[model samples]
Structures are given as C-alpha cells and as structure tokens.
Target: MAERRANVWLAAWRRAVLDRLPRNREDAPWLWILAAQAEADLSLARRMAIVEVLRDGRPHPAPDLQAAVEDRLGEGCFGAQVEQTLEADITSLRAWSIRIGCSDTPGVGGYYLKDPIVKAMDKPGYEEHPNPMQAQIYRSMGDARKMRSMFEMFEFALHQVGIGTRLRHPDWDDEQVEAEVRRLVTGIEPTMG
Candidate 1:
C-alpha cells in the first residue's frame, strides 16, 4: 500500500512538471505531456546526432544511432561513457502524430521523420530555427494560443466551480451550463435564463 501510494505521488509530480507547457485547451493534460517531452528532446544532443542517420527517410543501424548520441555528448566522467537512449526519444516524436511523425524499419531498427512535416520544415527558414521541427510546430500553434487560453479558462470554470452548480441542479442542461458559465465569467447572473 505504501509503495503504491509513493508511485501515485511520483506520477502526479511528473504530471505537474509537464502540465505547464503550452498546448491546446481540449485534452490539455496529454497534449502538454507530449509538448514538454518534445521540448526536452529538442534540447538533447542526440537530436542533432541522429539527424544524418535518419535523414534519408531510411532506417539506419541501431549502433550507428547510439554512436551518434555518444559522439554528440562526448565521453562522460573519468573517461567513462554515458549510455545511449536516442531510440526512445525518436519513438516519442513518432507518437505526437499531429505535430510530427516518423516511420520505423522493423528489420534493422531504423527510423525517419514522416514526409509531410519534413516538407513543412524544409522551407527556407528551416535552417534558421533553433530547432527546425519545433519552429514548424509553433507555426501552427501560434494561431491557436489565444483561443485555447480562453477556452481553457472557461472549461476550468465549467468543470471546477461548475460542479457545484451541476450538483445543485441535477437536471441542468446546456442552457443551465451556459448560464453558470456566464455568471462565473461576469460575476452577474443573466437577467433572463
């Protein structure tokens, strides 16, 4: 029981750390998790290390990727080396299908980014990006920032304090939800409902 409680607490801690990053308001928690993971990946030296390996849209050898990450990070403390974990990060990038995607080769464990995002990022400013893929993603997310923020705020109120209104009026419909929403927003009940 104690061990399970600790695991639960650890999971919540991880969730909170990743939750603050920017993402769509709808299904925000999972979205933020993906966004934060991608952002952290962008910072990893292995990201650049495997670019060439994965560049041709063909699978490359797993050892080649490990060596790339090793070379990128350089030898670790006391001439010892750090381990390679680039494969997992690449797998995660594949999971964020809307922002980016990838295809993996089963025979030799090779991978490459999906075509569309590569094409999008291949535009003129691609080289200029601190991280080209992230820049490409920001292009789409930029348009939705304000709207997502507003909707997130409204959704929070609707399910948060709105829970009380729901409990108070068990038969409430959209009309009631909208009424509570407006009341919460303006601090004034609608003149007519």
Candidate 2:
C-alpha cells in the first residue's frame, strides 16, 4: 500500500510538471517563478515574493544577482542566479522537498507549485486587452505569412504597435506597407481568437 501511494504521488508530480509547459512557454515571469519555486530550500512565502517581483519587473541579469539576493534574502548572502541554486534544480529540489514534507499534491503543498501560477498568468494575457494598441497593430497584420513563422509574426506585430521607431524605411511605398499590415491581421486573427 505504501509503495502504491508513492507511485501515485510520483505520477502526479510528473503530470503537474508537464502541465506547466504551455504557460511557461507563454509567460516568462511565470516560468521564472516555477523554476524559482522548485527550489526546495526556499520557503513557500519566499517563492511567492520572488514570483511577484518577476511578474512585475525584468529578469535578473548576472550583475544584478546581488540585488536580487538582497531582495529575497536581505542584503548579505551568497549565491548564483536563483535557478542555479541547488534548491532550484529539479531532481535535488524535488527529492529534498519531499523529504522535508512539502506535499506533492497541488494547493496543499507548502510552496506554490508551477501549475497554478502558470494558469493564473495565462488568464490575463488572453482575456484582458492590457495593451490595446499593441493588440490592434498585430491584428492589422494579415495572418497566413505570420503563422508560417512566429518570428516574422512577432516582428510584424511589434512594428505595427509603433515600437522601435516610427518607420525604419521612410521611402517604402504606402501600398506595400498596407498590404503587409492586411496580411498580418488576417493571419493572426484566427490564432489569436
């Protein structure tokens, strides 16, 4: 019976990790939180704080690791990026957390696990039009070509949103630009919907 229970927990943990992939791919901050929370040594409260910070700000570059450590542990510690910590590495973190009695199940677990945070982050990106102009610019670009390559679509989307510069090439024909816009809009609409 004990062996069966252990197997069940392991299976559940695998599923939970797998489920986190889509959200991790979409929202960078959520990914950082999941990676950070996976650290076994860090308490759940600390993990939550890290997630909040990442969601609101930029990723910590190597030079900024000291400040990040100070923010998390308060001004005086030692370490690398949070992800490099032994507590954040998967195999060690998972086993250690289990050993220390953090529940494998969702919600009941002491630390906020990856799945919920990912799901919650997923909600706003799709539902709320936080940046309507950006969304509109992407919408203007026709779809088929953009769908063919996400990189192209992303670049087109940014361009329409008036990012980087007013226009990189001032001499380009208006008809050509309009056609490109139409193409992106048509392409992205189906996917965005």
Candidate 3:
C-alpha cells in the first residue's frame, strides 16, 4: 500500500516537473533523471521543514503545521495534496529514526518530536566556547542561513566521500566509482550480477 502511494506521488511530482519544463528541455534524455533528483531534494526539504516546525517540542495542531510547511516550501509547491504529502514526509522522517508523536485525537490534538536532535554547539565540549553575544549573533542568522549551511556541509561531506572512494579504487572507471559512492552514502548494496 505504501509503495502504491509512493508511486502515485512520484507520478504527480513528475507531471508537475514536466509541466514547468520548456518544450525544448522536455525531450532531453536526462529530464527524468533531473526530475528524480529534484524530487529527492524536495522530499528532504519537506522533511527538514517538518522537523523545524516541530523543533520547539510543542504539539502543533495539524492545520497549523500543514500551513507552516506550505509557507516554508513557498506557494503552490504542495498543490492541493498538502496534507497527504505532509503525512508522507512525516513517515519518511520516522524511517530515518526521527521520533514524531501524533495526537490521538484526529486533527485537533497535534504533533511533536519525541526527542529533538541537539546541535553540536549546544553540547558541552573542550573546544572554544562562544560568548553570550556571539551565540545570540549566531542564532539571529535565521533559518535560511542555517539550511544553506547544512546543505553546504552535506555537499562537502559527499564530495569528500567521493574523493576517498576514487582514491581507494584508482582502477575503477567514473561510473564504478560513482556506484560505490552511492552505495556507501545510501547503504544500498548493488545487486549481484
């Protein structure tokens, strides 16, 4: 059932992407590949938005949370299926080991993170400690900066992994190296031939 729902969402997402693409770009063989990557990024962003909305650890009503996600994702991103998309996002987050609590009462109660992930800065360490003013400055940079920084960090990490993979397998071609990197990053083993 979940797989069927995912396929439905995937088809809808592909249609949306195709609708936005220029006629010239529509015939490109890589169009579907690009669409898949865009869908992955969108799914990640949606999950991140959900985590941010629930980060306060307070139970937020369903409608309010849905609206917050829509706002975070910008206008028209969710079409008319925002609620279903939000539920799927929540499920994806849970699959990644995030614990989200939904209210027993349908639509009225709320949702919250059972255990919010703490930032490294918040943890006690032997490194340099920021002054109270500096901490305030850091906090004031806002969500956009935070999200961008996270993406940059993620990209750098992936690049490093790719480099390491290439170094370790010097004889491998680019496709072989990329497959290894993908397997390592995603933990999905390649099928035995």
Q: Which stretches of candidate 1 lie over 4 Å from their true place?
A: 1-43, 76-84, 96-109, 116-193
Say which prediction, candidate 2 or candidate 3, comes out ahead on lDDT: 3
TM-scores, each model vs. reference: 0.27, 0.22, 0.38
Q: What lDDT score goes with residue 110 in model 1?
A: 51
- For residue 76, give model 3's deviation from the true position in Å: 2.4
Task: Kindly list the per-residue Cα lDDT of model 2 for residues 1-193, writing each as its tens digit.
Answer: 4234333433454356556676554445654455445343334423333443334223334324334434544432334454454245333434545322224453223322342232336456565656888777768877874576687766677567432222754665765555445544554322222
- Scored against the true structure, residue 177 in model 1 reaches a CA lDDT of 76
**TM-score-sorted candidate list, best first:** 3, 1, 2
lDDT of 3 by residue, 1-193 (tens): 4334434555665676577767855586576785566455666656766787898776788778877766666654555787787788888889989999987664337889988565657656764666899678768888999899778887787688899998988999988887778777766656656
| Candidate 2: stretches off by over 4 Å | 1-45, 53-69, 77-113, 117-155, 160-193
Top model number, lDDT:
3
lDDT of 1 by residue, 1-193 (tens): 4234333433454466556546535545665564445335432334534553465565455655555544444433112232334545565445644122333544435555444453444556646538878667657676579589668887787677777777777888978877876777667647753
